[model samples]
Structure formats: structure tokens, C-alpha cells
Target: MLIQKVRFERSPKLHAMMTEAPYPVNARVVVQGKRGPEVATVRDEAEPMPGDGRYGMILGAASEADLDRWAELGREAEDLKWLLRARARARGLPVKIVAAEFTLDGSLLTVSYSAEERIELGALIQDLRGHTRARINFAAVGPREQAMMLGTLGACGRENCSSHHLQDFAPVSIRMARDQQLPLNPEKLSGPCGRLLCCLQFEHTQYLDLLKDVPRKNARVCHDSSGACGKVVKLHPLEGTVDVLTDAGMMQGVPASELRVLKGEPAPGQQKNRPRD
Candidate 1:
């Protein structure tokens, strides 16, 4: 048995499954998904692992009729989305319907939604079940997942990373923005998902590597090139430069290589006797 990575049309993550024979990349195949047999596109070949049975099996390549049925199911799912929204509105529910998907056999209907807080969906599910013969399942998603489902554009005018090629969301923190010397404003720092921008982590490690040897802002230092002692006012990590305010009150952009930390005096905000990294 061989293993391959496949991706469902409505999902962002790739799934590993066991296939009896090799399949070319991007080939449409029917696989045993959580909802039952469903159409998925082959992403790539995956290395076989021990106990691959838990990953499920690829039933076979999708037939022409299977492809047609998949398309038809997509249209039906779209129609179902509007019905779900209307039903939720009638019940005064706070959920926003993001997407709807159906299994290949139409045995299961999965609905993805976003909400400000946890919502009791027992009544809503009951009402939906009454209207459709297929079993209904509701999935609650966070802001980032909602953005991924909607396929929104980011500030850079490109498709969102979460919606594009990012297989998983990495942990992003406000400390990343602060380390990069970015403005703390929420609007500028946030992506379309209203969370910290995912790109903040892209160059973060590079910035950390550059700043490791450089003195912190407002730290007392002496410039070797001009032999002038001054305080570091700003850092240009990418350029390997620092702006120093000299004792004569003149500002000069000095290379980080030429500046050495002055002894005993700490950076303005730093505590005494504590060594700065």
C-alpha cells in the first residue's frame, strides 16, 4: 500500500490516506473522508507510515459521473447555505454561516460557522435535520478559520496566507510586532482575519538574529569610528545600523559593528545591575 496526501475542496489542511496504487498529482479521487466517500484532489505522495490504516483508504479514482456528481453537490451546498442563514435568522441566532459541504453520496451535510461566543445549536440542528434527509453537523470556527473559508485578501492585496498555501497556522504574538519595531495600533497590525498578521513571523527570526548582538534602544554606547560616546536612539536591524544621539546632541547613523556598550550605565528603561542581552 502507498500513502498520498489529498485535499478536500472545502478544507485548508491536507489529509494523508492509503492508496493501493500510485496516483499522479492533482488527480481527482474518491477517498473515505470523515463524512464518508468524498471527492478530493491529490496533493502529493506521502511516505508510508506504520499503522497507515488509521488514515483511511482511497476507494479509487473519481469517475466522470463522480466528477459530475461532485459539481452538482457543490451547487446544492450553495443553496443549502442560504437556507441555513435564513433559518438561523428566524431563530435569532448569532452565528454567521461560512460554508456548507456534502458527502459524495449526499449522506452527510456539514456546515461551518463563526460566532462571537459559544452558541447552543441544538434547536438549529434540529430544525435543519427536519428539512434535509441528510445528517447535519455544525462546525464552529475562529476568526482566522472564517477568513480562510471566505478567501479574503490581506493588506498586501494578495490572497490570505491561511487561505492560500499555509497548511497550518503558526503562533503569532504581539511580542513579534514589538520586536520588529512596528506600531502597536491594532488596525495596522491585524490582517483580514482581525488577528495579528501572519507575515509578522516571516522575517521575525532574521530580525532576532540581527538584534542579538546589537544594543537595545536608549542604551549608552560609544562609536568606534568617530570615537564619540552616545546613546542608541533607534535600530535598523535590516541594515545593520543604529541611530546614535551623541553627547553634543547630534544624531548620526552608525554601523552596529562600530558601537560598543558603555560600561556601568544601563539603557534608560533597563534596570541597574541587570546585564542586557
Candidate 2:
């Protein structure tokens, strides 16, 4: 059914499935809970089945009946919100519960909330279980997930990364920033994930393509009779010009075609700079 494997909170091995999911590494699905139906975005997918012992769940596609049932239960989300708020206050816990969803069959209930510390939610779960006669699960998602769920305005004044269409969460390295010659500013480079933005990976291949024929910035080569040889400071691959700081105390731009790249160390007496004078 082209179901992708996904990861859920606490259940690292638990996977969710999606049908015709748009995002490359992400998808949105309706989770069926005992008390109500909830919507969740698929984080990871299981496909080709990685040999790794990672477990996954095929949260099969939601049927039309499931959608209608979820719509009916959505009306009760506000009531669930108020109940959760009152419970947290009674317990003297600083927490905020946003939304709640129940399964199509009203067998499961999932509550979405945010908090700083690990607050005990046993009483809350018990209350919900007793009243709804269904399984209650509380998921504490990070800011990244929060943004995905609630949506937000980004630095560009548009919708945040996940909402706009980012799928995979690849680990970005400082090496990538350096390669792109971007300033290492957390505010400038990081996304709602508080990590390097995933968009940086988009055009990286183009930069790599441009760099293949270019020489490193630290190449040394002899200049004319001036013996002006130093590290390469700049390179224009298309123009074939390489700017090098020479021993003569000046930066000279020379055509890359005119200079021979040294292999290992230059052989002695072959400086190519000593004139017959």
C-alpha cells in the first residue's frame, strides 16, 4: 500500500503509514484513539525495511468513516482543553495543553501539550480513562513539532519550515555552512528546529558542481621572474584566474592555466624564478 515507516514519541520503533504522502520524509495522518481521533504528522517512514532492528507501524490510511468520526469528535476538543487546563492547575503544574483527539472508534485518546519539566500526568490519564473508557496517551513534543502542529511565522515572514514543506530532518554540519561560505549565525541559519535549516541542503549540489574544477585556496605556485609564490587566495574557475599572495609582498592574480599546481613539495633548483641575470 506504499505505507511509510514512521516514529512516534516514547515508541521509537512504532511507525505510521501514509497513502500518497507528499513530503519526502514526512506525512500527516489521522490517529484513531479510544476517546477521539487526532491528527499527527509522520516523522519517519519504513520502506525497503532497513536491516536495522528499528520497529515500525503501518498506521494504515484513514477511511471515509474515520474522517467523519474524527470531525464529529473535533467539536469536543475545546471541552478537553478546558478539562486538561483545570487539572494541571489543580496539580500546581505549569503546563499548557493545546488540543486533544480521539480514535474513530473512541477507543484511544491522545493529548498534545507543552511543558518544561517532567510533570506527573498519572491523575490526568486516570481521569480521562475513567470518563472516556479509552486509552489515554500524552505526548510532549519539542518546539519543532509544536511548530509543525500549530504553525508559525518564520523569519521570512512566511509560514515556518515544516508547514511550508520540509520533509526529512538531516543532521546539518558546520562543514556545510563553511562550504557555502555562510556566516555561522544561529539566528540566521537555524530554523524552527533550532538547528541548521534543511533548506541548506537544497542547492548544495550546485555549489559542489562549481567547486570541482576550482583549486584550493592554499595552493602555492611560482610567479614570473619575481619568484612571487604564495598561497592561493581566490579562484575564478570560469575565468581561469587565481589570485595568489607572492613572496614579493603583493597579491598577484594569474591565470590558472599559466601556473602548474605543485605535487607534494617543489623539487629544489626548479624555482622557475631565478633569471639568467
Best by lDDT: 1
Tens-digit per-residue lDDT, 1-277, candidate 2: 2456444322323344434433345454564432334544566544554445433333455557756766776666557767888988988878878567665566666788888888888878876754677677897976566666666677778887665565644556665655565667889988775767766777666645554544556756765555567777775544656788876678888875556556763422342322111
The whole-model lDDT of each prediction reads: 0.83, 0.61
RMSD for all candidates, in order, please.
Answer: 3.3, 9.0
TM-score of 2: 0.57
**lDDT of model 1 at position 80:** 82
Task: List the candidates' TM-scores in order.
Answer: 0.91, 0.57
Candidate 1 lDDT over residue span 1-277, tens digit each: 7789998875568888888888889999999966798999999975655663578689999999999999998898898899889989998999999999889999999899999888898987787776679988898889888888888888999988888877888999887887787878999999998899999999988877777756787789998777898888887877888899999999999987788788875432343223322
Name the regions of candidate 1 deviating beyond 4 angstroms: 50-53, 265-277
